[model samples]
Target chain A: MRHLLTTQGLPRDEAIAILDVAEDMAAVGEREVKKLPTLRGKTVINLFFEDSTRTRISFEAAAKRLSADVINFAAKGSSVSKGENLKDTAQTLAAMGADAVVVRHWASGAPKTLADSGWIDAGIVNAGDGTHEHPTQALLDAFTIRRRLHGSASRGRDLDGVSVTIVGDIVHSRVARSNVWLLTTLGAKVTLVAPATLLPVNLSGWPVDVSFDLDHAIAQGPDVIMMLRVQGERMAAAFFPNAREYSKQWGLNDERMRALPASSMVMHPGPMNRGLEISAAAADSPQSTVLDQVRNGVSVRMSVLYHLLSGAVER
Target chain B: MSVRTVLQHADITRALTRISHEILESNRGSDDLVILGIPTRGVTLANRISAIIESVDSAVIPAGALDVTMYRDDLAQNPTRPTRPTDIPHGGIDGKTVVLVDDVLYSGRTIRAALDALGDLGRPRAVRLAVLVDRGHREFPIRADFVGKNLPSSMEERINVRLEEIDGVDEVTIG
Candidate 1:
């Protein structure tokens, strides 16, 4: 409850509790007022060291919906961009009385450092950090999955006996890393599908079934298929052969999309490369929960904030 | 699960009569009273409480059901059938003493969420919580102002209250 750095270390019951609470928070979003006075006088700060539209906005919205006063600090125009250290920024936010800080940083363990450094007393949440973890995003994805598969039945169930295939850009995707650990922890069998070069070295210790062939992984019939975005920015240094070739071999096109099981759900942590990692049709399909992931992000984040602030722990 | 019936139909009816008299005596009159149920079972409890008050006093107490499900903190953990419509009475909650009625009190989370939910309707002069069973395991620091029965039980044991309006039987059991 102190900090939500990663879903890797969380107990299954605790993680499910957060997801369950998010279901309630999602209800508040569908209301006429679209807000609650739970954190009436509390202050939440969105500290972004990296440029992000969805996560920053989602955290801001979640805080506002809970009636907490929000302050957005982006490194682009702020003092942090001008070479101010994280220590100074943490100290400053602390001085301003931030009850909770939702941080998205380029460095892998920035949130952990902030939470453990004692530079601030605020509850620190990792919005995202490098290729390390995006716990909240993974949580929302799991929330979406539990809703799609179980509905209210999520109370007693884990992702047990479910198979999840994560496709593309494993090397640079925090989503993939987060899901691999989280889904595995919840008892779902995870399979990684990507080109050998894009796959991380020494993933043998990670609890997942690895595959270099997308067709083979598809044939395995996973319960959920999470397609990761090919980071073109990271690929400018020739990480892959070419866009056309990558799309041909690893991309999710009509054939691969059609090959998926009827009950299987398709997911993507956006902003997507329309014709690169996944086609336009797959992104907009009925099986797609990309949009629902965005909507559920608010609720999932609200659940995180509520637990961190309200101190609601599952017994 | 072994369930022991704690309250019979007559016991419930007698408690309703006593609660109505107590509410009327404390508030001086039923003029500014508004009974609001906390959805599902609370609506029935609020109705019965309102009916009992009406019989004891000359004037009628306005009653309605408010759905606080949408304002809960954990909406996505379980599958929700989508948000249900709330039926608020004519004049709204402004300048009125809104008494929130519920069947059981566990962690006080429901009531805490209900307070936030009520603020959106309009500002109430005062808001009070009343529960049939105060089972005394509070995660949040919340308490019911009025109680029908204070049943002490472990967190593992649940108090199942079945009203005639919904369950076709009026009884309180511990399972």
Candidate 2:
């Protein structure tokens, strides 16, 4: 509970607790005030070392809704551009008396570094840390899935025995990585579907079945079908033959979308590639949880902040 | 520690029966009356009271639970308290008489938080407080409208209200 750096080692009870708390946070969002006095007089700094508008905004909204004073510090054009390292920046944030820090860094273990380092006494949350983990994203995805599956009675429940088939770029997907650990922890049977080129070299240790065919996986009629965005920026090394070929082989097109059961959930952690990773029809389909994922991100982050800062755990 | 049972199961039933009658009398036969309990044991008490009123008056009164953990002021002292779900009745609390139910009325801070929580949800026409036991330590200028038993006790004493719905017993004990 000290820091939510990753979902890898998060206990099942704690995961359910977070989801339950997120349910409460989601209720607050439905209220006329849409704000809580929970984290009042606390300062939460959104320290972004990488540009992620969606995540930064979600964290900011979560903090704001909890009535926490927020300080946004993007590392692009700040003193970071003038060679101020993480330790120095953290020390600066520490001096400002930050109660919590939601950090998204390009480095894999940057949030852990911030938490482990003695520079700051604030609760450090991994907004995202490169390809290592995006715990909240995975949490929100899980929240959305739980809500879709169980509706109003999803409190204190894990995604037990549900089948989820995650499609597309697993090698560069922190979303996929987070889901792989979290879903498996929640007792969901996960099958990762990706082209061999886009998959990580080692899946032997991971708790998931690997399949290269999206159509074949769709034929199984899993409860949830999550389509990951093909990270084009990371594809500089020719991960696939081309976009059209990749779409042809692994994309969630209309035909592939129609093959799934009506009860199946289509999820994407957006900014979705409409025609590349998922077609427009599938993206806008009734089965899609793209918007729900974004909406739940705020609640999930609120629960994360509340868990991390409410107890004010020692570093 | 000396433990004394202030109210037994039958005594609780009698008090709740009287409280239900008082509520029906005050509200004039349960028209637009929404009974909301401040979670945990309050919910059980609310349900019992609601059921009693329904049986006696032959009219259904909506009952629900309101969780005020987010609106609390004691997060600095004890912050790790998990929130219970807030379920307002389907007709909602707007323009209705809301009788806030709880097991014990102590520091009155919980009621204050519940008031805040209620304001965010919807505006009730009138709000009243009801408690199974009013162990008067009132830190705030608040008092319960309907009380099952007003057991005057010291600040050092702990009041425990156990119900069959949750704790497999119906007893109010002070130690």
Candidate 3:
């Protein structure tokens, strides 16, 4: 409960509890003055060893809405750029009395290391880490899904019978990994659809179905069709031959989008590769929960920070 | 050990009716009046009061829920539960008389938290407290404006208020 490093082994109750709390936080956002005095005297530091403006700003917004003082530490300009590692940076922040640290790093287990190393006393929240997990992203996705399915009466409910199909870039997507673990924990059936070259090598023991064909997976009538971003920057070598080929094979194209059930949802942890991974028609479709996911991210992050610093364990 | 019933179903109804009358009398006809219930049982009670007020005077009072989970002072000592939604009535609480209704008024800590929670959502004209049971071991200098019953109890004893809307039973029990 102190640090949300990953969603790999997060218990069902704890995961559901975070989602349920996020529902409350979302309700608060609906108010005229969207602000709370919960973390009044607390300080939350956004310690990013990687550049992620979206996540950094989302965490900053969450903290600010809760009335907590925020210090955004981007690695580029900070001591981290001067070769001062996480330990020195975290220790310095801790000394300044940061109540929580929302960290995004290129190293996979950077948040875990910061939490377990005892270099800092602040609660560690993983904004994201290299291909390992983006717990908040998964949590916000869950929140968005729950809200869509159950609406305002979503509290205390889990996605028991819901089927989710996550497509594209499974190899480098922390979002997909987090979703696979968290959604499975919350009782959703997950199916990972990717091109063969885009998938991970070892999928043994992971509680999900793997499919190379996106068309076949869509035919199964999943309740959610989550399309992950095809990280062009992360592609050192071509994971696929070309963008057009990749889009044709794996993307949620207009034809594939038309094939999806009306009840099913379209999702993306965005900065979406509109034409490449998901067609603009599909992304702009009413079935898309992409924007809802972004909006829910703030509330989900708020819930995480609340659980970590609000002086309560699980109920 | 078994529990004893302090107030039955009919008793709760009568108490609410009387409380509604008292509220109507005090507020002088529900103008810019908002009844905000602290979540769990309080929200149900608030809605009931709102319904009753509407029935009596034909005035549609805005009823909302105020969840004080994050504002709680004893959060460290209690187990963390998922927070309930805080739904403020449309048009906001600005310059409106807010009546915070709860199932029980024990240590007044919840009311204190509710007051703090209310502060963030625009300034109300006045905020008052209403409780089904006023168990007298208060740690804070807070009092209820409308009390269904002033059943004084020992610190060791617990007051359990079960409503039909929430628990499928309407009764107050002391254990």
lDDT of 3 at A56: 89
Sort the candidates on TM-score, descending order: 2, 3, 1
CA-based DockQ, model 3: 0.63
Question: Measured by TM-score, how close is model 1 to the native structure?
Answer: 0.76
Candidate 3, residue B132: lDDT = 90
Q: Which candidate should be chosen as best, given lDDT against the real structure?
A: 2
Query: Which of 1 and 2 is ahead in DockQ?
Result: 2
What are the per-residue Cα lDDT tens digits for candidate 2 across A54-154? 99999999999999999999998899999999999999999999988999998999999999988898888988788889999999999999999999999
* lDDT (Cα, tens digit) per residue for candidate 1, span A172-280: 8889888888888888899999888898888867888888899888888889999999887666567778899999999889899899887889999899999999999
What does candidate 1's lDDT look like per residue over B56-142, in tens digits? Answer: 787889888877764676643544323333556778788999989898998898898888778887889888887887899898988
Off by over 4 Å in 2: none
User: Which lDDT tens digits does candidate 2 get at residues B13-124?
Assistant: 9999999999999998889999999989999999999999999989999999999988888766664779999999898899999999999999999999999989988999
Model 1, docking class = incorrect
Among the numbered candidates, top DockQ falls to: 2
Off by over 4 Å in 3: A312-315, B1-3
True contacts kept of each: 0.05, 0.62, 0.75
Cand 3, B chain, TM: 0.98
